[model samples]
Target: MDTMRDRFAPVMTELLDEDPRVAVVLAEIGRDGLAEAARRHPDRVINVGIREQLLIGAGAGLALTGLRPVLHTFGSFLVERPFEQVKLDLGHQDAGAVLVSGLGSYDWPAGGFTHMAPGDVALLDTLDGWTVHVPGHPDEAEALLRHAVAAGDDKVYVRLSVQTNAEARPVDGARFLTVRSGGSGVVVAVGPMLDPVLDATGGLDVTVLHATTVRPFDGEALRRATGAAGADVVLVEPYLAGTSTAAANDALADVPHRILGLGVARRELRRYGTMEEHIAAHGLDPHGLRRRITRFLDGAARGGS
Candidate 1:
């Protein structure tokens, strides 16, 4: 399956060619893929080695100088490692950069927690007005990248993971699109979480709503989807568990709500294995999601035991 990260490099290269002001700053990730772009536009595509902090700071500096900058690196290093830079430089300084992060959550399970970033989105949410986009497919990633790069000074985060959906869907603003509808409850799928969520809720009576842009969440659209169904929402994210629980609550707070938040575990499992193993350990696999969702919705339907 082609990943969003795979398409990220080429799309960025295209951006570099199309616009001279478009610059890409990297920290030894995706360098090979963007080699030609770097060679052609050496001034635009720069590799700051392993200095994640400098990678972000340089991007901020570029943005401050009337250039649209983009920073790319592993999720953990990009968000967790140079977080101070992200928060202060780009965010606090009011400088803007297109942060294209790859290897989300347990995408590189063998690399262990050092490489995994289950809380990238949560960290970004701490800053003000950062647009977060988690594309389920390469096409969506490409479209969103173009949109963000051309957006001019808007802080944008495009998260890419190894897991991908079978196909691409239309990229809408922040409106939650219905993948499969039902009368039982609603399932909000974030990014790559769509495929497994669909599989998990396949046999159940539930409405599945897919969300690619999470931050600046379309609460209105979500409210419309919930309607009068008691606001039983299942938010399936690829990052830290319960990351979007608060957003869901606020969206459906007008009505009494029961939300089941599912994603990477908060506690460090300290286990290193395959991506599937890590996902299973976090209870994010299809069977596990189905069991957890059914259990929660069943209990909710019964008015809680």
Candidate 2:
């Protein structure tokens, strides 16, 4: 729905009004939608029209001057095109910002690969000090947004889109909240993957853990939850498959473990269609995920490679 728009506009405006240290940088998007906030604050809400590099550069400059800049745009334009700027401008300068992106994964399938960014999170993982968040619901988004903005000196990237869970779950900056408990395995659902993960594990005896704040992943919590059975872990993410494989390994170190990673396909479909179509092809839909997870769990139980 309008969760993407509403999350940016109203919450941003409120943050701007309450915090003088906050500023906005737009890459030709959300400029007019926040016109009044720009008018009210004059120099804070900047519309850097289409120049993605300059948009990030400007945000870095603002941060250097003791202002917390919140940059907004679609995922590809915000992170991919201007990635060098994101690295050199903010990272090199040792600056921090809240880079909030809209239209995640294939949210804008009509716009083609140029508009979609399934690798943004993986890219951010390369850098230091970034806290990536993929909110599953509007409430989770708002809470995470407020927390990121208030943090001021933290480097945060929030991916917002139309995909959402049916309801909200308890959220924190660096902890995985358990949604269901069972002995067979643990299904870690990141962001909107909660719905599909839940559906896939419905009949299976497993533990389900939810996470909106993914990066700096809740490794400690993960260890504790899976300690008893040392059960299987099925990480279902909304971005690239196995992006957090290494982190999962580190978290489960010192114990024998197995993990099945599910996410957006690394290979492109090479055809444009609806989000549902793309999801089905990638085996991310509930039914598709269920089949894959079921087979994996069964094979693992049988001691098959």
Candidate 3:
């Protein structure tokens, strides 16, 4: 059971060897993992030595030349620190690249709040034409990574994290997979939140849908799952809470619905503890989730908004 980041290196190295149009730009992180690839193809596998902006800039430059570039770094530095460059270079120029991020919202609690990027997806939401993939397992990560690189000229974000499900669900790079069917409500579990969501929703009459590609958000699938007016939806994500709530609201706009967004909260915890502690603090663990989800569902059923 390798971590998503652990699988990313070798999969990327293989992609570099197979595709002449594929390139990787790094910012001094994950260098050791892809060192062999860098040695094999110096021009294609590049490390910009801790310059986040340059990492994106170089990837953008490669994209402009018609080569697919995959940018790698921690979520905060990759998306937040160099956001201006991402906005102008990729979005403004219409150049496309694959931005693969590691160390999700609170994967490394000791790394401090600076390393945690709960708003990465939400920030990308401000931009247009970006595909975001949040894979729950290493295998799914590889699948999504290959799909993004092969898509060519499409801006894609593949978010990788240490938090993973015990098993890998089938991922087609798009569309949410229905894990369970129930009549009361639908629980949309994104990426690594699947196991916790399933655990939390145990015995509850709620349909569960697993999402890997979240940007193009499968509203149609959600529509099918709920199948009636005034549906109740709980989005269990590993990033910022309510990040996808608006998207869900828009998806169910025509119908009356209630949504509960659960994930990392807005405030910084500021304390360095175990990742499990952070999870518990954010109420994202199975125990907290069960309590919250049950309460929400109960309220909705009782005619409470």
Candidate 4:
């Protein structure tokens, strides 16, 4: 099985090859992978060095000139550093450039707090006309890349994980993945945490909905799922609680929801570690999640009893 980066690189290369007008923009470390893709498909790649601000600006400029640019970089640099350019040049103009943000949510341990960006979803979601997608697996990343490229007139931000899992399937847009079937409750997972949620639920009638795309949430689907299960929906994410999960709950106001947000307190910097370690430290691991879900269900049952 190919790593998420390996699978995505080739698909992206193919997409660029298939479309003559599409240009690939590579930033710093992400440029290494893009370089390999460029070597295979030379005409479509553009190397922009380490300047994230300039990279996004160039991508936006290229888009204005009838070229579809796929800006690639780490999530933190892409969203935080070049936000002004993304907001003004991309969002304001509706440039339609595909912003591929890789290594999302504490992917690089040594990169430290300066590189850990948990708010990319929040920032991108707030932007009008921008589609924010967080693919759980490489297959979904590939599919969503194609969809974003074909979308033509809308800005797209795709959050990609560094590590790949065997369970990650190819999917498009904001569609959710049903990980378990049960009558107890619905556990909505965002990002790579879907695997753990499944493990925690075991034999319970807990249905896990893996939300690959955070923005433009599937409200109707959520309502249908919750209604069908006859249980409260619990949203799990690796960022601050008030952003994606809260917004999603608001979108489906008819359904009751509980949001579990995981991140540094007050956005403070913590010890650097892998994504799993970070999640575990914040009580976002499988055991913690299981306890919370069980407690929620038990409390709900008690109220009824």
Candidate 5:
């Protein structure tokens, strides 16, 4: 199965061929995959060398001219490095672009902390009116990419990751899909975190909801899963821990609800190791998820915080 990043070039190529208004901007990252696209559409496919800020600025400039721009880079450089450009050129100026990111969080642990960006979503959360898509599989990524390109001047972020689930869940790029149903609680799995969340919640009486488009948050779907009065909800994300807890709390503010957010911890692991080690250290593996999810539900059942 192809990774999400692997699907980007082909999808973008198709878009560039079909839509004359669609353009791509890069900062010397993932240029090899898009070389053919650049060859075919030299003016549309732009490479601004290592200038991450220029990449975003160019994309925003394209957007200002009524062209849809898709910007590509590692999550750290894509969002963190050019954040001011993103906030001003895009958000402030009302210029929309599709920011497609690779190497989510710790996909390449060997690349060190500089390459990791677990806080990308959280930082974007500070801004308003941005749609974020964290697809679990390449198929979903391709679909969301197309959706964003055709979105007509809406700010969108497509977060691509090397860490993918064994299978792709059907994602409409808008609402959350209900994977499993139960009465105990609801387990909302975002992006690639679905498989592990399913494994962790197996045999346990809890509803499992798969989320590919996380920006909208899908509070209605979550409310339906947890019932009107509210109940325990565990959020298993591929990025920062407790990232969506505030949104969950606001969604359930009308009733009594307990939420346990689980994902990559804020604390950095300085020792270089495999990505699996990073995942384990962050307690995102199935075993760790099961332990934490079970404990949280058990505690909630006992009327504890």
Candidate 6:
């Protein structure tokens, strides 16, 4: 199976090929991959050196000239280093550009924390008019990209990862993916962690929600899903506890949510390893999550309160 990165590049290439107006701005590292596509389809890609700020600014400029610009770069560099440029050039101008941010979270293990962007959601979510999409799989990424390209108004930030895909049921709307069916409680999982959630809840009557879109969430659908699973809800995310999930819990005040998060001790990681190792180290492995969910289900069953 192709990784999300491998799958996404081709879809983007196809889109650029079919549409003459669509042009790609490839960062230094991404240039080779995108350049090959450009070569095959000539007239679609613009290679920019390793300048994050300039890359976005130029992309915004391209959008102003009636061209669709898709900017590609490392997630950390795109959001962290080019903060001002992205905010002023892209967000402020309401530039219709798609930012493909690669290696979200610890995807770039060898790149270290400096290259890891676990806070892209919190950072970009604050910007007005910017749509932050954290897709769980390649299919969702392709679908979301198609939607964003056709949108033609808002700025888009796609936080992509090399993580393996979860077996999520195809999403029909902008709502989250409901993994396990239940009428007792809801567990809202962020990103690819939905796979682990399903593994954890083997025979339990708990509903698992995979949140594909982090911003501009489908409130009506969320309410319906949580309501269907009763009032008890638990939010699971790889990010810090008080970020998106916390804010969402506050917004849905009527439904009580138990925010289960990665403990504070594992917040700023120092070592390098695979995603599985990191997840295990932080007690997010299937066994650990199973124990937690079992406890929650047992408690809910005992009182039915």
**For residues 193-285, could you state the per-residue lDDT of candidate 1 as single tens digits?**
889899998889888888988988978877877786566888999899899999889878868778889988888878788888888888888
Clashes of each: 0, 0, 0, 3, 0, 0
Better of 1 and 4 by lDDT: 1
TM-scores, all candidates, are: 0.97, 0.98, 0.98, 0.89, 0.99, 0.88
Q: What are the clashing pairs of model 2? A: none
Q: Write the per-residue lDDT of candidate 6 for residues 23-135, one digit (tens) a residue.
A: 88876867767667878756568776878888889899989988888888888888888889888998788788888888867776778888877777667766887776777
Candidate 5's residue-wise lDDT over 189-227, tens digit each? Answer: 999999989999899999999999999789989999989
Pairs with steric clashes in candidate 1:
none
lDDT for position 244 in model 1: 91
Candidate 6 global TM-score: 0.88
lDDT by residue for model 3 (199-262), tens: 9999999999999999999999999998867579999989999999999998889888899999
Q: After superposition, how far is residue 303 of candidate 3 from its true place, in Å?
A: 1.0
* Between candidates 1 and 2, the TM-score winner: 2
Off by over 4 Å in 6: 40-44, 166-168, 228-230, 255-258, 261-266, 294-305
C-alpha RMSD in Å of predicted model 3 compared with the true structure: 0.8
Q: Cα deviation in Å at residue 158, candidate 3?
A: 0.4
Worst 10 residues of 5 by lDDT: 296-305
Pitting candidate 2 against candidate 5, the one with the higher lDDT is 5
lDDT (CA) for every model shown? 0.88, 0.88, 0.93, 0.73, 0.93, 0.71
Comparing 1 with 4 on TM-score, the higher-scoring candidate is: 1
Stretches of candidate 1 above 4 Å error?
none
